[model samples]
Target: MHDSSHHSVDPVLAVLRQYFGFEAFRGFQREVIDHLLAGQDAIALMPTGAGKSLCYQIPALLLPGMVVVISPLIALMQDQVAALWQNGIRAAFLNSTQSSQESAKVMQLARQGAIDLLYLAPERLLMEHSLTFLSQIPIVLFAIDEAHCVSQWGHDFRPEYLGLSVLSERFPTVPRLAVTATATALTRDDIIKYLKLQQAKLFIASFDRPNIHYTVVAKNDPKQQLKRFLDAEHLHDAGIVYCLSRKRVEEIAEWLVQNGRRALPYHAGLDKETRQRNQSQFLQEEGVIIVATIAFGMGIDKPDVRFVAHLDLPKSLEGYCQEIGRAGRDGLPANAFLTYGYEDVIKLRRLLINSQLTENLARSARQQLDTMLAYCETTNCRRQMLLRHFNEAYSHACGNCDNCRAPVSTWDGSIAAQKALSCVYRTGQRFGVEHLIDVLLGKKTERIIALEHMQLSTFGIGSDLDARQWRSVFRQLIAADLLVIEPVYGGLRLTERCRPVLRGEQAIRFRQDAKAPIAVKKDVQAKRGTLSVHHHSKELWQTLKKLRQDIARQQGVPAYCIFHDATLQELIDKRPITEQDLSKIYGIGSRKLKEYGADLLRIMKQFAPDGIDV
Candidate 1:
C-alpha cells in the first residue's frame, strides 16, 4: 500500500520513510542530518530518546560511503546494527564480540562500499591497524556516540576517548558529528575541545523527557522502600534497579528473585560471560529486571524499560540523567524511581577521597556531587533542577515529577540547625553524624561517654527529637552547605555558611521527609495490564508481541529490534491485513514489509470479523 521510496520528492525524506518508516524528523534530527549531508561538522546535545541515531543513520543512507560510528559499548553497537539490519539496511558492528575473521569480513564489506553503516567501539577503531585500514577506505563521515566520555569530568569518562581527536587529523575531508545525552557545561566544553569540533554547529535539544515520571524518596529503609516501589509501580515490568556496589547488585537481584521476579545482577565484577548473558536476557526478554552498578548501563538502548530505580545515589546528576534516560526511550510513558540518603553521600565521598584523582579533578567531582545533592534536596520541580545541571532552561514546573505531583512540606529549622552545628562544634568537629546525633540526643553511647560529650552544653539540647529526626536535620544541614563532610574521617565540619544560622540571622527550613509517594496515573503505563488498551485490542496487542518475540528468537536479535512496542501498537491500531495496509503504517518500510508483512498480516487475520472476507 505505501511506496515511500519513489513517491517522495526529497531523497532524505524518502529514505527515512522507506527504510525507517517515519513521516518526518523529530527535534533536531532533520537539521543535523542536513548539515552532515552538506559536509559540515556538528555537535548534537540531545537527551536520550530524542532520535539521536537517525541524525547519522539517514546521512549514512544518502552519503556515498559507509558511516563509521565510533560507539563506546558493544551492546549499544549490537542493538543499533541489529535494528538497522532488520530495517533492511546493510549495517554491521566490529567489536570484542567478533573474532578476527569476522572483523576482517565486515571490514572487507566496508572496503567494497557494501555497507551503509559500520559501528565499533572507540578503542577498536583507535587501534593502529584499524586506523590504518580505515584510512584506506572511503569513509563518508565519522559519528561519535556518547561524546561526553572524552572529558575527565564526565560521569563515565574513558581515558581512551581522549584519543578521538585523531579522527580530525586522519579524516580531514569527512564530516564529524559528536553526540552526548548527558553533559554539564564543563563536560560539554570538554567534548567539543577533545573531539576537535571547534567549528561545528551545536544543536541542544530540551533535556526534559516528558514521558518519564520522576520520583525520588528519602531512603528510610531501602530494601523495604524498593520492594514497595516495585510492588506499587513497576512490579512485573521490565526495569533496572541501580545500586552503588556490586555486592548490593547481587543482593538486590537475589532478593528480587526471591520475591518472585526474573531479576539479574550485572557489574564489572561478574565474569564477562555472565554479564553478557544477563544483558542479553534483559534486552531479549520482557519483564526482566537488572540490578547493577554504574558499570552496567552506559549505552543500553532498550526502548521499553518501564522504569529505572536507583537504590543509592548516583555520583553526579550527569550520571543520574544518563542512567534514568535508559527508561522510556520509546517515547511511551515510563517512570524513574530513586531512593537516596545522607549515608550514600558519605560513602561516595569516601570513595572519591580514597582514589588517586588529581586535586582539581577531585574538587570537580565533589562539586558535581554537591549539585546532585541539591537536586535531591530541592523543594522545587525535580525536572527543572535536572535540566538546570545541563544549562537548559525548563522554566515551568513539569507536573510529571514527584514534587509537582505532591508538594513537600517544609518547617523552619533555625533552632535545629543551631543545635546540629553546635553539637558538631562542641563534639570536636571531627565526629560523623552518628556520634554527633548521639551527643545531641543525649545517648550515653560508649564513644560519646568516652569523649565526655555528655557534659557539653549542646548535649541533651536536642533530646526532644529522635535519632531519625536528628539525622534528617543533619542531612539537610549538609545539603544546605551549613556543614561539610570532611574527606579524611568522613566526619561533619561546620562551614562559614553556618555562622549566620548560628547567630539566628539566617533561618534554615528543612523538608519534612515524605513517605514513598503513591503516584498512579492511568495515562502513564509502567507495567503490563496497565497500558490503556481497550479490552478487545488487548488480545491483539499480546498476539502482536508474541509474533515479534518469535521472529526475534528465530533471528537471534532483540524483540524490540524486530519491532518496537510503538510500532506493534500502531500495527494493532491500523489492523493492517495486507502488504498495502502494512506499508501505510509507521516503521513498516518497504524492506520491513518484505521481511515481516506476511507474518503480521496472518496474525491480524485471527482478529478479523467472522463474516468479513479474509
Candidate 2:
C-alpha cells in the first residue's frame, strides 16, 4: 500500500509522487536509492516490473551532478529518455541514431550541468572521444543497466561490456550502480567481479511475479494452437508472439493479420526502417501484436502487454524467464504460454553442438538447455520451478499455472524408462531421437538396417507403445537426468541416474502431456472487484484512450507516455469532476495535472455528470 500523502510536504517522497505519480517506493527502491545517495556502489537484482529504473531515476534527481547510465540497446535508451521527459526530468541520450548536431547539443547540455541523467551505450562510452569528453564532466555516479551482459554465463553476453570496467578505473571516486532483471548466482558473481564492484551493496528483490500465469503445452499444430489461444484468451489485446526464426516471425505476423488481427513483424532480418516502424507501432498503437524473433524485446518498456506466447523452445531458462518477464509489467494479470515439441529440443541441441562456443561455454549452455527441458517437462508447479532455478524457494504451489488448474495424470514410468535407457545403450548411444524412436517402434528402415541395430537384445522388446508415446518417455528421461545428449555428436546417452531406474531400485513417475485446451478464457481485468464499471464506463474508458492517443500523436510520443491504463483505470473509478479532483488520482503528477487537467476534468464531467462530486 502507498503512504497516501501529497508530495509538496516531503522532498524525497515529493519527487516520487510529483513526477512518477507513486506514493511509495516498491521493494528495495528506497534502500538502493539511499545507498547510492550515501555515495556507495550497489547492485540490484529486481524482477522486470519491480521498478528497477526508478531506483536510479529518483536518485539522479537528488544527486548533484549528472548520472551517466550505460545502456545496451538504442530503443531502450529512447524509451527511457522519452519517459523521463514526460516526467519533466532533464534527461538525454547519446546514441548512434542521433545526428552530429543533436549529439553535440546533448553533450553540451551535459557539460553545462543541464542534464540530470545521460544514457550512452557501452560501445560509445568506451570510445576515445566520448571518454575524453566524459572525463571533463562532473559525473556524480555511473549506472550499468543490464549488468548481466558482462558475464559469459548470461544469456545476452556482450564483449563490449568488458570495457565498462574502465568506468571504475577512470572515475574511481564516483559511485557505481549495476542493475539487471535476470541474473543467476553465477551471473551475479560474474557481474560483480567483471564490473569491479568489489564493495557494492547487493539488493535482491523477490523474483516472484504472481500476476503472470504460466502455461507450457506440447506443440501440436503450433500455428493453430497459437491462433486458438490468442482468439480465445486475448482478443483485441496487445501482446508479443516470439518465434525462433525471422521467417516464422513474418509468417506468423501475416497469418495473424489475415485472420483479422492487427499485427506487425519485427526481427533483425527486416530492414532497419521497417523494424523501427513496426516496433514504434507496437509501442504507440493499442492492441497491436508484434511477431518477432528474440531480438525484438531487449528493453521494451510497454507496460500493458497482456500476454507473451512462445511458439518454440527457448535455449535456456534464463532466456525464457527474461522473455516471459516482459508481460504483466504493470502489475496486472497477464499470461505466458509456451508450446514445445521434441523437434525443438533436437534442433536446439544440434545448434548448440555446431556452434563456435568454447568448451566451457558450450558445456554451460548444454546444462542450461537441460534445465530448460526439465522445466518444460515438470508437472508440479511452473512458478515454483522457475523461481527455484534462481535459488528462490517456495514451499507451496502457485495456483495460476496449468498444472495447478488442471492436474496432470502421472504413471510409474520405471519400466518405460528402462526400455528407453536400454534402447540408448544397445543402439551404441550414437543415434538421435528419430532413429532411436524408429528402432523402438520396430520400424525396418534403411538406416536401421544399415546400422544393423535390429539384432540388439533390446530391439523391439518394448513395442507395446507407439512412437509418440516413446518420444514423450524419452523426453521425460532427459528431463529427469536419466539420459543426456552428447554435445559433440548430438546423440542420446545414459547418465549415472539411469542405473537406479534400470536396476528397478528406484521408481519414477512421469506426467503425460495435458490435452490442449480448445479455447482459453480472456482473464485480464484491471483491479478485479473494484472495476465494476466494466459495462457502464466502457465508452468513457475508450474516450479517454482516444484522447490520450490524439495527444500522444501531437506530442510524437508513445500513448503510454501520456497515461498508463492503470491511470485511466483510476479515472474510471474516481469519476473526477474538477481539476483538484483529477490531480488527486493516482499517476496524475502535478505537472500532468496542470498541463492536461482541464481537458481530463471536462471528459470526466461529460461521462459522469451525476457522479461528479465537485
Candidate 3:
C-alpha cells in the first residue's frame, strides 16, 4: 500500500491553498503537478473546465523564478494573465495587442524578477530577440497551452507551434507542460512527437461533462427552429450561436440585436477591437449573445454561458466538443443545441475531401464527422451516445435532453436495419449512404441501374419503409455496429458482426427515429428584463467584481481570469479579514494575497467593519 503521509505537501498546493483557497486538487491536477514539480516534461489531455490551467499555474507559483506560457491566441493569453493577477499573482503577457512600450515594460519586469508568470503567443516567441530575452530569465517551467495546435492534422493548427521544440532543446533542465482539451489518439501521438516530449508524463482525464445537455434538431426551416430554441425557457441565459459563414454570423447577430436581444457578431473578418470589445462585453454582461463563426471561441474562459447553439454543423466532433464545452464551466446545467441536415453533411464531406492533408488524415477527419453525425441522428440516449464515443461507459439515459424528456414514438426497426445491412453486403460494400438508401427504397434511377444495384435481392426488401425511414435505418445500423462506413472507400460496409443478424441467428433492435422536438416560444417581456439581483450583500459582490476588473484591466487581462465565479461566491459567503483568513478561501494563494490582499480588505471595510476583510 502507498504511504499517504509521505506525499509531502507540495509548495504549489500551499500556494493553491493560500491564494485560491482550495483544500484539494481537482481531476488530474495532483498527479500532473507532481510530475512537473519533479522536473519532468508532461502532456495533459483534459476536458474543458477540468482545471488544466491549475496544473501549470500551481507549478509556476511554486517553482522559483518565472514560467513562460506559450499560447496561440492573444485574447486567451490576456484572459489567463488577468486571472493570475486576480489571485494576487504577478503575471504579464507579451502579445500583438500591446504597444512597443508596453511590451518593453513587461519584458523589463520579467528580467527584473518582478513577474512570476509571462504569457507569450507562439508567433511572438518565435522571434530571435524574444527567445534571447527569454533565455535570460530564470525560467522554472515552460507551458504550451492548447498543445494540439502543434499537429498539422488537428482541427486548429498553427505552423509557429511546430518550432516550439527548441524551448526543450535550449532549456534542457527546465520542466515543460503541454495542455489541450481535445485530442484524438492520433493528435495525442503527434503532440508527443512534435513537441519532442517523448519522456513526458501523460494525463488523460475523463471527457464526460454531465452538466451539458446534448440535443440535435433535424434541419428544416432552421431559422424558425432557432427562434424557438431562443425562446423564454433559455431567456436571460448567456449563450453562443455558431454560424458557418461570416455573412451568417453578421445576419444572425443583427437579427438577435434587432429583436432586442443583447447580441453581437464575431468572425475573422471583424476588426480586432470590435471582436475584442464584443467578447469582453459578453464576458462581463449577463445575457449577452455572441453570434460567431468557427473562427471564434478558442481559449475563451466564460464560465456561466448557459448554452451553445449551432446554426450550422461543425466540421468535426473535436471542434464540436470544444465549442460546446465552453458552456456550464461552473458546473451548472447547460444545453448544446445542434441543427442537422443532409446539405450540412455534404458540405462538410466536400470540405474534407478538398483539404490538402494526406488521405489518412482526411479519412480520420471524415470518420470523426461521421461519428458526430451518428450522435446527432441517433434515437438512443443522447448522453450515452456521447459518452460511448469517448470510450466511457454510461448506462442510464439522461432525461434532460430533447429526446429523453419528450421521447418520440419508436417502432420496431429490426426488419429495416436488416434490409440496410443486406444492401451493403449485396453491393459488395462499395456504396455510400445515399446509394444504399436508393437500393432499399426500390429507386431504380439511372445511377442505380448503371451500378446494376437493381440485381441485388435486398433492392425491394425495404420497400415498405419510405425514404426517410430507410435513411433512419441506415443511421441506426451504423450506431448499432451492424454497419460501418469506409472513409477511404467513400462508402458503407457490413461488419463481420453483422452476419448473425443477416442469417436470423441474432436479433437486431433499433429505436424508430423520433420526430424533431417542437420549438417553444419565448416571452419577449421576460427576455428583455434585467437579471434579478438577489444578494445578501449586493453592494459587496459588485465592489468585489469592480476591484477585480480594475486590477485586471491595469494588468491588461480579462476579468474572470483573476478569480473564478466560485471563488467570488466564497468571498460573499465569508469575507476574509486577514491573510490567513483569505488563504482559507478556495483559490487564494500567498502570491495573490501579497498582491490583492489589501484591495479585498479595503472593499470589505467599506461595507462592514466587523465583517472579515481580506
Clashing pairs in 2: none
Candidate 2 lDDT over residue span 259-352, tens digit each: 9999999988889889989999999888999998888787789999989999999998899889988997888778899998867877788888
Best by lDDT: 1
lDDT of 1 by residue, 541-562 (tens): 8898898899999999899988
lDDT of 3 by residue, 1-614 (tens): 88898778757667777656679888879999888888888999988888788887877778789988888888767666666666677889998888999999999999899998888989888889998998898999999999999887667898889999898788898889999987787789989998998999888888888777777876667777777777734766789999988998999889887877899999999998998899888876657999999888888888878889997888777789999999878665677898876556656666766678787877788777778777776667887877677677888987766677667666766566677777788888887887877887788789988988788798877778787766666766665667765645458778888888888777765655555555432342223212223464777877887887787677665556566556676777776766677777766666666777788877766766454332
Name the top TM-score candidate: 1
lDDT over C-alpha atoms for residue 508 of model 1: 84
Winner on TM-score between 2 and 3 is 2
The lDDT per prediction is: 0.87, 0.86, 0.78
Stretches of candidate 2 exceeding 4 Å from the true structure: 1-8, 424-466, 486-491, 518-533, 609-614
Candidate 2 global lDDT:
0.86
Worst 10 residues of 3 by lDDT: 524-533
Find the 10 residues in a row with the least total lDDT in model 1: 521-530
Candidate 3: where is the Cα deviation over 4 Å? 1-10, 393-409, 414-510, 516-563, 567-614
- Clashes per model (N, Cα, C within 3 A): 1, 0, 22
Error of 2 at 526 (Å): 9.2
Score residue 240 of candidate 1 by CA lDDT: 92
